[model samples]
Target: MQKTGLLFGSFNPIHIGHLALANYVLEYAPFDEVWFVVSPQNPLKNSEDLAPAQHRLAMTNLAINAEPRFKSSDIEFSMPVPSYTLNTLQRLNELHPTHDFSLIIGSDNLINIDRWHNFRTLLQEHSLLVYPRPEYPIEKAVIALPKSVNVLNAPMLDISSTLIRKGLKEKKNLRFLLPAGVYDYILQHRLYQQKKE
Candidate 1:
């Protein structure tokens, strides 16, 4: 049976950090493929700063073009906005019965997992691979997570999409922060650039 891992997030512009996490998970864990499930809108975030779903998806594709193990998905775009994790997992399970699915999340997200829609049910169904973020504590998160959670001390970079956007707005080069193709795409589209006062 094929084992697939789901790395769900609002990949505003898929950065090098995101790719690093995915690659690390694949290397450390037992998964055939890692899918980048791009969320349309995160209920907990402000949508104003988010780029259009299509644009984000296009950028994600460009970012992952060099990695055969990384696949970009727009499943949430087809579903309702502010898509819930439970629903997405259920749909994926049904559509690909032959593949065993696991959820890959950051330690920070695990701290707020209780707030997600039907989070308890989500935990029961899917195995989880939790990675550590810059400041988040793994031990503290491990105490709160269910038994299905697997904590990974994989290599991490202190880069974020928010930081990348800020760099773009300031007209700064995002040299190693994002994939070369993705950086070029952002410049070509003038994304994240501040409007003239």
Candidate 2:
């Protein structure tokens, strides 16, 4: 079975960091493809802070267009608001029974894995590919990780969608922060130029 890694995020605007991580995982991991699962809203995040789901999805698609192994999935857009990872994984399994699915997360998320809905069950049923995040040392964690988790020393970037948005709003020199097409899309749409009301 082909292995697919799911990277779930709001992707308010997709950036090079997101692409780099996914590309690095594809090169190093057993995954044949990596899907950018664009969530409409994370349960922990404020929905009002998000770009329109369609725009976010579009940006993700634009960011990954050149990579055949990278895909953009709006799986949570049609689902209920504040989608859970467990639910998305189950649904993907049901939809694509032939492929093996793994959840891609950062070390920070691994630290808070228990907070996820049905997290224990999710861990038991699916493999997790964890990458490094600054200040969240996976090696020093006190929590006993399950056998299903694989930690990778993938490259970490200090860039984030939040940072990109702030930079755009402030007219900072954020060139190369995003893919050329994605940055062009954001500028074309005039997104993140004004302060939020």
Candidate 3:
């Protein structure tokens, strides 16, 4: 059976860190392709701060287009708000039963898994591939992880969408932090410069 790693996030604007991390996961982990699942509504976050789902999906596609193993997923666009991983995973299984899917997430997200809806059931069934995140220590997470969970040693950068958006609002340099095409698209569309009113 083909294996696919699902990396779920808003991808407000796909950046270099996101692409780099996805590449790292594909190279070091056991998976055929890494799908960047762009969430339309993340329950833990305020949707007002998110870019439009189509724009976010487009940016993600631009960032990963050159890499065959990387894909942009808009699966959550038609799904209900405050998207639940369990529901999405269930739907994905129904849609593609032939492929085995693993959840790829950041170490920080793993720490808060208990807060996710039906997290326990999701944990029991699916394998988790975790990467390090800034300010979120991994050692404690490892102590309590399940047998199927894998903590990757991929390079952890302090980059975040918040800081990137702040830079854009302030007209600061963000050349290296974003992919060229993704950055260009953001610039062309004038995204993340001001909150949507």
Highest lDDT: give the candidate number. 2
Q: Residues 1-197, candidate 2: write the lDDT tens digits.
A: 98899999988888888888998989899689999999988997776657888989998887888889998898887788779999989899999999899899999888887788888899899999999998988966556888999999898887888898888888886768888688788888888887658
Q: Which stretches of candidate 2 lie over 4 Å from their true place?
A: 139-142
Better of 1 and 3 by TM-score: 1
From the highest lDDT down, the ranking of the candidates is 2, 1, 3
Compute the lDDT of residue 195 as modeled in candidate 1. 73
TM-score of 2: 0.95
13-123, model 1: which lDDT tens digit per residue? 788888888888888796889999999999878887788888899998988888898898888888887899889998898888998989999888887787789888888
Report lDDT (Cα) of residue 100, candidate 3.
90
- Candidate 2 positional error at 183, Å: 1.3
Candidate 3, position 168, lDDT: 89
RMSD each, Å? 1.4, 1.4, 1.8
Q: Candidate 1: lDDT of 94?
A: 85
- lDDT of every model, 2 decimals: 0.86, 0.87, 0.85
Model 3 CA lDDT for position 128: 91
